[model samples]
Target: MKIRTIVFLTLFTCGSLALLVGSWLQVIPFTLTEDLGFITGALSVWLTVVENIWNFPIGIANDIFFFVLFWQAGLFADMGLQVLYVLLGLQGWYLWLHGGKNKTSLRVSNISPLELLVLVLITGIATTSLTFYLQTLQDSAPFWDALTTVLSLVAQYMLNKKFVENWYGWILADLIYIPLYIYERLYLTGVVYVTFLVMCLFGIRAWLQSRRAYA
Candidate 1:
Protein backbone atom coordinates (compact mmCIF):
# COMPACT_ATOMS: atom_id res chain seq x y z
CA MET A 1 0.00 0.00 0.00
CA LYS A 2 1.01 3.60 -0.53
CA ILE A 3 2.20 5.59 2.49
CA ARG A 4 -0.80 7.90 2.28
CA THR A 5 -3.28 5.02 2.16
CA ILE A 6 -1.59 3.36 5.12
CA VAL A 7 -1.71 6.59 7.09
CA PHE A 8 -5.40 7.06 6.27
CA LEU A 9 -6.34 3.53 7.33
CA THR A 10 -4.40 3.88 10.58
CA LEU A 11 -6.11 7.16 11.44
CA PHE A 12 -9.49 5.77 10.49
CA THR A 13 -8.97 2.72 12.69
CA CYS A 14 -7.88 4.83 15.65
CA GLY A 15 -10.82 7.15 15.27
CA SER A 16 -13.22 4.22 15.05
CA LEU A 17 -11.74 2.67 18.18
CA ALA A 18 -12.15 5.93 20.06
CA LEU A 19 -15.81 6.07 19.04
CA LEU A 20 -16.33 2.49 20.10
CA VAL A 21 -14.80 3.20 23.48
CA GLY A 22 -16.88 6.29 23.96
CA SER A 23 -20.06 4.45 23.07
CA TRP A 24 -19.19 1.66 25.46
CA LEU A 25 -18.62 4.16 28.25
CA GLN A 26 -21.94 5.89 27.51
CA VAL A 27 -20.10 9.03 26.44
CA ILE A 28 -21.78 8.51 23.09
CA PRO A 29 -25.52 7.88 22.84
CA PHE A 30 -25.17 4.91 20.47
CA THR A 31 -24.91 1.29 21.61
CA LEU A 32 -21.60 -0.62 21.44
CA THR A 33 -22.84 -2.80 18.61
CA GLU A 34 -24.15 0.23 16.73
CA ASP A 35 -20.80 1.94 17.06
CA LEU A 36 -18.98 -1.16 15.88
CA GLY A 37 -21.29 -1.49 12.90
CA PHE A 38 -20.88 2.18 12.09
CA ILE A 39 -17.12 1.97 12.24
CA THR A 40 -16.80 -1.15 10.10
CA GLY A 41 -19.52 -0.06 7.69
CA ALA A 42 -18.04 3.38 7.12
CA LEU A 43 -14.52 2.06 6.74
CA SER A 44 -15.64 -0.65 4.34
CA VAL A 45 -17.36 1.87 2.06
CA TRP A 46 -14.34 4.16 2.12
CA LEU A 47 -12.08 1.27 1.18
CA THR A 48 -14.48 0.27 -1.57
CA VAL A 49 -14.31 3.80 -2.98
CA VAL A 50 -10.57 3.30 -3.36
CA GLU A 51 -11.05 -0.21 -4.78
CA ASN A 52 -9.23 -1.73 -1.81
CA ILE A 53 -9.51 -5.52 -1.41
CA TRP A 54 -9.67 -5.08 2.39
CA ASN A 55 -13.24 -3.83 2.02
CA PHE A 56 -14.60 -7.39 1.84
CA PRO A 57 -13.21 -8.54 5.17
CA ILE A 58 -14.21 -5.32 6.90
CA GLY A 59 -17.64 -5.56 5.27
CA ILE A 60 -18.13 -9.06 6.61
CA ALA A 61 -17.42 -7.75 10.09
CA ASN A 62 -19.81 -4.90 9.45
CA ASP A 63 -22.47 -7.38 8.38
CA ILE A 64 -22.12 -9.38 11.57
CA PHE A 65 -22.31 -6.27 13.74
CA PHE A 66 -25.34 -4.94 11.92
CA PHE A 67 -27.03 -8.31 12.09
CA VAL A 68 -27.02 -8.16 15.85
CA LEU A 69 -28.02 -4.51 15.91
CA PHE A 70 -30.90 -4.98 13.48
CA TRP A 71 -32.17 -8.08 15.22
CA GLN A 72 -32.35 -6.16 18.48
CA ALA A 73 -34.16 -3.35 16.72
CA GLY A 74 -36.69 -5.83 15.22
CA LEU A 75 -35.72 -5.04 11.67
CA PHE A 76 -35.99 -8.64 10.63
CA ALA A 77 -35.46 -8.09 6.92
CA ASP A 78 -32.36 -6.02 7.52
CA MET A 79 -31.13 -8.64 9.96
CA GLY A 80 -31.54 -11.32 7.32
CA LEU A 81 -29.83 -9.12 4.77
CA GLN A 82 -26.67 -9.14 6.84
CA VAL A 83 -26.39 -12.91 6.50
CA LEU A 84 -26.52 -12.56 2.73
CA TYR A 85 -23.92 -9.81 2.89
CA VAL A 86 -21.49 -12.11 4.65
CA LEU A 87 -21.90 -14.70 1.93
CA LEU A 88 -21.52 -12.06 -0.77
CA GLY A 89 -18.49 -10.54 0.95
CA LEU A 90 -16.65 -13.84 0.93
CA GLN A 91 -17.43 -14.32 -2.75
CA GLY A 92 -16.34 -10.77 -3.46
CA TRP A 93 -13.06 -11.28 -1.65
CA TYR A 94 -12.15 -14.16 -3.93
CA LEU A 95 -13.45 -12.52 -7.10
CA TRP A 96 -11.47 -9.38 -6.43
CA LEU A 97 -8.37 -11.49 -6.14
CA HIS A 98 -8.86 -13.75 -9.19
CA GLY A 99 -12.33 -13.76 -10.81
CA GLY A 100 -11.12 -12.28 -14.07
CA LYS A 101 -9.97 -13.44 -17.44
CA ASN A 102 -7.80 -16.57 -16.87
CA LYS A 103 -7.73 -16.11 -13.05
CA THR A 104 -6.40 -12.57 -13.13
CA SER A 105 -7.42 -9.64 -10.95
CA LEU A 106 -10.85 -8.29 -11.84
CA ARG A 107 -11.21 -4.96 -13.65
CA VAL A 108 -14.04 -2.45 -13.34
CA SER A 109 -16.59 -2.55 -16.11
CA ASN A 110 -20.08 -1.38 -17.10
CA ILE A 111 -23.26 -3.46 -16.98
CA SER A 112 -25.20 -4.11 -20.14
CA PRO A 113 -28.66 -2.66 -20.67
CA LEU A 114 -30.20 -6.11 -20.63
CA GLU A 115 -28.47 -6.93 -17.35
CA LEU A 116 -29.66 -3.65 -15.87
CA LEU A 117 -33.22 -4.41 -16.83
CA VAL A 118 -33.00 -7.88 -15.38
CA LEU A 119 -31.60 -6.59 -12.10
CA VAL A 120 -34.32 -3.99 -11.83
CA LEU A 121 -37.01 -6.57 -12.41
CA ILE A 122 -35.48 -8.93 -9.90
CA THR A 123 -35.14 -6.23 -7.26
CA GLY A 124 -38.74 -5.20 -7.71
CA ILE A 125 -40.04 -8.74 -7.37
CA ALA A 126 -37.88 -9.52 -4.36
CA THR A 127 -38.82 -6.31 -2.59
CA THR A 128 -42.54 -6.95 -3.08
CA SER A 129 -42.33 -10.51 -1.84
CA LEU A 130 -40.18 -9.57 1.13
CA THR A 131 -42.44 -6.71 2.05
CA PHE A 132 -45.44 -9.03 2.17
CA TYR A 133 -43.52 -11.54 4.27
CA LEU A 134 -42.36 -8.86 6.68
CA GLN A 135 -45.87 -7.48 6.93
CA THR A 136 -47.07 -10.91 7.95
CA LEU A 137 -44.58 -10.73 10.81
CA GLN A 138 -45.79 -7.22 11.73
CA ASP A 139 -42.50 -5.57 10.89
CA SER A 140 -42.12 -1.81 11.06
CA ALA A 141 -41.45 -0.16 7.72
CA PRO A 142 -41.75 -3.44 5.92
CA PHE A 143 -41.76 -2.00 2.42
CA TRP A 144 -38.85 0.32 2.98
CA ASP A 145 -36.82 -2.38 4.67
CA ALA A 146 -37.50 -4.82 1.87
CA LEU A 147 -36.68 -2.21 -0.77
CA THR A 148 -33.32 -1.39 0.73
CA THR A 149 -32.58 -5.05 1.34
CA VAL A 150 -33.11 -6.08 -2.26
CA LEU A 151 -31.34 -3.04 -3.67
CA SER A 152 -28.34 -3.68 -1.46
CA LEU A 153 -28.19 -7.31 -2.52
CA VAL A 154 -28.10 -6.29 -6.19
CA ALA A 155 -25.54 -3.60 -5.49
CA GLN A 156 -23.30 -6.00 -3.58
CA TYR A 157 -23.47 -8.53 -6.40
CA MET A 158 -22.57 -5.87 -8.95
CA LEU A 159 -19.72 -4.75 -6.73
CA ASN A 160 -18.43 -8.31 -6.43
CA LYS A 161 -18.22 -8.41 -10.22
CA LYS A 162 -16.41 -5.03 -10.27
CA PHE A 163 -19.20 -3.34 -12.14
CA VAL A 164 -19.03 0.45 -12.10
CA GLU A 165 -22.85 0.72 -11.82
CA ASN A 166 -22.93 -0.73 -8.32
CA TRP A 167 -22.51 2.70 -6.76
CA TYR A 168 -25.77 3.88 -8.24
CA GLY A 169 -27.69 1.10 -6.51
CA TRP A 170 -25.91 1.75 -3.23
CA ILE A 171 -26.61 5.47 -3.46
CA LEU A 172 -30.31 4.79 -3.92
CA ALA A 173 -30.44 2.40 -0.97
CA ASP A 174 -28.48 4.74 1.29
CA LEU A 175 -30.85 7.58 0.57
CA ILE A 176 -33.74 5.42 1.73
CA TYR A 177 -31.77 4.09 4.70
CA ILE A 178 -30.92 7.51 6.10
CA PRO A 179 -34.49 8.42 6.95
CA LEU A 180 -35.40 4.84 7.83
CA TYR A 181 -32.69 4.58 10.46
CA ILE A 182 -33.63 7.92 11.95
CA TYR A 183 -37.26 6.84 12.07
CA GLU A 184 -36.16 3.76 13.98
CA ARG A 185 -34.27 6.01 16.44
CA LEU A 186 -30.93 4.68 15.25
CA TYR A 187 -29.60 8.20 14.85
CA LEU A 188 -25.95 7.23 14.60
CA THR A 189 -26.78 4.61 12.03
CA GLY A 190 -28.69 7.24 10.09
CA VAL A 191 -25.60 9.42 10.13
CA VAL A 192 -23.56 6.50 8.87
CA TYR A 193 -25.94 6.05 5.95
CA VAL A 194 -25.61 9.72 5.15
CA THR A 195 -21.86 9.23 5.05
CA PHE A 196 -22.40 6.17 2.87
CA LEU A 197 -24.40 8.27 0.43
CA VAL A 198 -21.39 10.56 -0.01
CA MET A 199 -18.85 7.77 -0.22
CA CYS A 200 -20.86 6.08 -2.96
CA LEU A 201 -20.49 9.15 -5.16
CA PHE A 202 -16.75 8.91 -4.74
CA GLY A 203 -16.94 5.20 -5.49
CA ILE A 204 -18.63 5.93 -8.80
CA ARG A 205 -15.99 8.47 -9.76
CA ALA A 206 -13.09 6.30 -8.67
CA TRP A 207 -14.40 3.19 -10.42
CA LEU A 208 -15.09 5.10 -13.59
CA GLN A 209 -11.53 6.42 -13.59
CA SER A 210 -10.27 2.89 -12.98
CA ARG A 211 -12.29 1.57 -15.90
CA ARG A 212 -10.94 4.28 -18.17
CA ALA A 213 -7.40 3.52 -17.06
CA TYR A 214 -7.91 -0.14 -17.88
CA ALA A 215 -9.18 0.79 -21.32
Candidate 2:
Protein backbone atom coordinates (compact mmCIF):
# COMPACT_ATOMS: atom_id res chain seq x y z
CA MET A 1 0.00 0.00 0.00
CA LYS A 2 1.04 3.56 -0.61
CA ILE A 3 2.41 5.40 2.44
CA ARG A 4 -0.30 8.04 2.20
CA THR A 5 -2.98 5.37 2.15
CA ILE A 6 -1.41 3.69 5.15
CA VAL A 7 -1.36 6.97 7.03
CA PHE A 8 -4.97 7.70 6.23
CA LEU A 9 -6.06 4.22 7.29
CA THR A 10 -4.20 4.47 10.55
CA LEU A 11 -5.72 7.83 11.43
CA PHE A 12 -9.21 6.66 10.55
CA THR A 13 -8.89 3.48 12.57
CA CYS A 14 -7.49 5.20 15.60
CA GLY A 15 -10.09 7.95 15.56
CA SER A 16 -12.94 5.49 15.15
CA LEU A 17 -11.69 3.34 18.01
CA ALA A 18 -11.29 6.33 20.30
CA LEU A 19 -14.79 7.49 19.51
CA LEU A 20 -16.25 4.06 20.17
CA VAL A 21 -14.43 3.71 23.46
CA GLY A 22 -15.31 7.19 24.67
CA SER A 23 -18.96 6.70 23.83
CA TRP A 24 -19.13 3.27 25.42
CA LEU A 25 -17.60 4.66 28.58
CA GLN A 26 -19.69 7.83 28.53
CA VAL A 27 -16.51 9.77 29.05
CA ILE A 28 -18.10 12.75 27.43
CA PRO A 29 -21.66 13.67 28.20
CA PHE A 30 -24.23 14.46 25.51
CA THR A 31 -21.73 14.95 22.70
CA LEU A 32 -18.81 13.40 20.82
CA THR A 33 -16.41 16.18 21.77
CA GLU A 34 -14.49 14.10 24.26
CA ASP A 35 -12.83 12.01 21.58
CA LEU A 36 -10.99 14.96 20.06
CA GLY A 37 -8.24 14.88 22.67
CA PHE A 38 -7.34 11.34 21.71
CA ILE A 39 -7.21 12.33 18.06
CA THR A 40 -5.02 15.32 18.78
CA GLY A 41 -2.75 13.27 21.03
CA ALA A 42 -2.36 10.73 18.26
CA LEU A 43 -1.43 13.46 15.80
CA SER A 44 1.02 14.97 18.24
CA VAL A 45 2.57 11.57 18.80
CA TRP A 46 2.96 11.10 15.07
CA LEU A 47 4.48 14.53 14.64
CA THR A 48 6.81 14.04 17.57
CA VAL A 49 8.06 10.86 15.98
CA VAL A 50 8.78 12.71 12.75
CA GLU A 51 10.31 15.66 14.61
CA ASN A 52 7.90 17.86 12.73
CA ILE A 53 7.12 21.40 13.87
CA TRP A 54 3.41 20.70 13.48
CA ASN A 55 3.40 18.98 16.86
CA PHE A 56 2.96 22.41 18.42
CA PRO A 57 -0.40 22.89 16.74
CA ILE A 58 -1.71 19.53 17.84
CA GLY A 59 -0.27 20.16 21.29
CA ILE A 60 -2.33 23.33 21.41
CA ALA A 61 -5.49 21.35 20.77
CA ASN A 62 -4.62 18.78 23.40
CA ASP A 63 -3.86 21.48 25.95
CA ILE A 64 -7.07 23.35 25.27
CA PHE A 65 -9.26 20.32 25.75
CA PHE A 66 -7.50 19.30 28.94
CA PHE A 67 -7.71 22.86 30.16
CA VAL A 68 -11.47 22.85 29.93
CA LEU A 69 -11.71 19.43 31.48
CA PHE A 70 -9.52 20.40 34.42
CA TRP A 71 -11.39 23.65 34.95
CA GLN A 72 -14.66 21.80 35.09
CA ALA A 73 -13.16 19.44 37.63
CA GLY A 74 -11.86 22.32 39.74
CA LEU A 75 -8.23 21.56 39.04
CA PHE A 76 -7.44 25.22 38.83
CA ALA A 77 -3.68 24.88 38.55
CA ASP A 78 -3.98 22.48 35.65
CA MET A 79 -6.59 24.71 34.09
CA GLY A 80 -4.30 27.72 34.31
CA LEU A 81 -1.42 25.63 33.03
CA GLN A 82 -3.17 25.27 29.67
CA VAL A 83 -3.15 29.00 29.21
CA LEU A 84 0.59 28.81 29.67
CA TYR A 85 0.74 25.91 27.25
CA VAL A 86 -0.84 28.02 24.56
CA LEU A 87 1.76 30.71 25.01
CA LEU A 88 4.58 28.17 25.15
CA GLY A 89 3.33 26.48 22.00
CA LEU A 90 3.55 29.74 20.16
CA GLN A 91 7.01 30.36 21.52
CA GLY A 92 8.18 26.88 20.60
CA TRP A 93 6.85 27.20 17.06
CA TYR A 94 8.75 30.41 16.55
CA LEU A 95 11.90 29.05 18.17
CA TRP A 96 11.91 25.94 16.07
CA LEU A 97 11.32 28.02 12.96
CA HIS A 98 13.77 30.83 13.67
CA GLY A 99 15.78 30.67 16.88
CA GLY A 100 19.20 29.91 15.55
CA LYS A 101 22.29 31.59 14.27
CA ASN A 102 22.65 32.58 10.59
CA LYS A 103 18.86 32.86 10.42
CA THR A 104 18.49 29.11 10.63
CA SER A 105 16.08 27.35 12.95
CA LEU A 106 16.90 25.71 16.25
CA ARG A 107 17.41 21.99 16.57
CA VAL A 108 17.04 19.56 19.43
CA SER A 109 19.75 19.87 22.04
CA ASN A 110 20.44 18.26 25.39
CA ILE A 111 19.56 20.17 28.48
CA SER A 112 22.27 22.53 29.71
CA PRO A 113 23.34 22.16 33.31
CA LEU A 114 22.41 25.73 34.19
CA GLU A 115 19.00 25.41 32.59
CA LEU A 116 18.35 22.14 34.38
CA LEU A 117 19.25 23.66 37.72
CA VAL A 118 17.00 26.64 37.09
CA LEU A 119 14.14 24.38 36.11
CA VAL A 120 14.48 22.36 39.31
CA LEU A 121 14.53 25.47 41.43
CA ILE A 122 11.59 27.00 39.64
CA THR A 123 9.48 23.88 39.80
CA GLY A 124 10.24 23.40 43.45
CA ILE A 125 9.23 26.93 44.38
CA ALA A 126 6.16 26.88 42.21
CA THR A 127 4.94 23.59 43.63
CA THR A 128 5.43 24.76 47.21
CA SER A 129 3.60 28.03 46.66
CA LEU A 130 0.78 26.43 44.76
CA THR A 131 0.32 23.73 47.35
CA PHE A 132 0.15 26.20 50.17
CA TYR A 133 -2.28 28.47 48.37
CA LEU A 134 -4.46 25.61 47.15
CA GLN A 135 -4.70 24.14 50.65
CA THR A 136 -5.99 27.49 51.83
CA LEU A 137 -8.55 27.49 49.07
CA GLN A 138 -9.97 24.14 50.27
CA ASP A 139 -8.86 22.36 47.14
CA SER A 140 -9.24 18.64 47.23
CA ALA A 141 -5.86 16.94 47.51
CA PRO A 142 -3.93 20.12 47.11
CA PHE A 143 -0.46 18.64 47.55
CA TRP A 144 -0.85 16.11 44.78
CA ASP A 145 -2.49 18.63 42.51
CA ALA A 146 0.28 21.14 43.10
CA LEU A 147 2.97 18.54 42.54
CA THR A 148 1.52 17.40 39.24
CA THR A 149 0.88 20.96 38.21
CA VAL A 150 4.53 21.90 38.62
CA LEU A 151 5.77 18.73 37.02
CA SER A 152 3.47 19.23 34.08
CA LEU A 153 4.82 22.72 33.54
CA VAL A 154 8.39 21.50 33.51
CA ALA A 155 7.51 18.66 31.16
CA GLN A 156 5.78 21.10 28.85
CA TYR A 157 8.79 23.41 28.78
CA MET A 158 11.01 20.51 27.84
CA LEU A 159 8.60 19.59 25.07
CA ASN A 160 8.91 23.08 23.63
CA LYS A 161 12.56 22.40 22.89
CA LYS A 162 11.93 18.83 21.83
CA PHE A 163 14.00 17.76 24.76
CA VAL A 164 14.14 14.05 25.56
CA GLU A 165 14.02 14.98 29.24
CA ASN A 166 10.44 16.10 28.75
CA TRP A 167 9.33 12.50 28.60
CA TYR A 168 10.97 11.78 31.93
CA GLY A 169 9.03 14.59 33.51
CA TRP A 170 5.85 13.35 31.85
CA ILE A 171 6.37 9.83 33.07
CA LEU A 172 6.82 10.94 36.68
CA ALA A 173 3.95 13.41 36.57
CA ASP A 174 1.54 10.95 34.95
CA LEU A 175 2.31 8.28 37.52
CA ILE A 176 1.45 10.67 40.32
CA TYR A 177 -1.53 12.11 38.47
CA ILE A 178 -3.09 8.74 37.74
CA PRO A 179 -3.55 7.97 41.43
CA LEU A 180 -4.67 11.51 42.13
CA TYR A 181 -7.23 11.33 39.37
CA ILE A 182 -8.44 8.00 40.66
CA TYR A 183 -8.73 9.31 44.20
CA GLU A 184 -10.68 12.27 42.87
CA ARG A 185 -12.93 9.87 40.91
CA LEU A 186 -11.88 11.25 37.53
CA TYR A 187 -11.74 7.84 35.94
CA LEU A 188 -11.71 8.94 32.32
CA THR A 189 -8.91 11.45 32.79
CA GLY A 190 -7.04 8.90 34.83
CA VAL A 191 -7.21 6.57 31.87
CA VAL A 192 -6.05 9.28 29.52
CA TYR A 193 -3.08 10.19 31.70
CA VAL A 194 -2.17 6.52 31.95
CA THR A 195 -2.17 6.38 28.17
CA PHE A 196 -0.06 9.53 28.16
CA LEU A 197 2.44 7.94 30.52
CA VAL A 198 2.94 5.03 28.16
CA MET A 199 3.28 7.34 25.21
CA CYS A 200 5.82 9.44 27.05
CA LEU A 201 8.11 6.49 27.51
CA PHE A 202 7.92 5.78 23.81
CA GLY A 203 8.39 9.45 23.10
CA ILE A 204 11.64 9.53 25.01
CA ARG A 205 13.05 6.73 22.92
CA ALA A 206 11.66 8.23 19.75
CA TRP A 207 13.07 11.68 20.35
CA LEU A 208 16.45 10.29 21.31
CA GLN A 209 16.56 8.49 17.98
CA SER A 210 15.50 11.63 16.15
CA ARG A 211 18.14 13.63 17.94
CA ARG A 212 20.82 11.16 16.90
CA ALA A 213 19.63 11.21 13.29
CA TYR A 214 19.58 14.99 13.26
CA ALA A 215 23.03 15.21 14.79
Each model's lDDT comes to: 0.94, 0.78
Residue-by-residue lDDT tens digits, candidate 2, 19-57: 767687887542233456656666675676556889899
Looking at model 2, report the run of 10 residues with the lowest lDDT sum: 28-37
Give RMSD to native, each candidate: 1.3, 3.1
140 Cα displacement, candidate 2 (Å): 1.6
Q: How far off is residue 22 in model 2, in Å? A: 5.9
lDDT of 1 by residue, 49-109 (tens): 9988999999999999999999999999999999999999999999999999999999999
Question: What TM-score does structure 1 among the candidates reach?
Answer: 0.95
lDDT of 2 at 53: 89
In angstroms, the error of model 1 at 23 is 1.4
Count backbone overlaps in model 1. Answer: 0
After superposition, the stretches of candidate 1 with alpha carbons farther than 4 Å from their true spots are 1-7
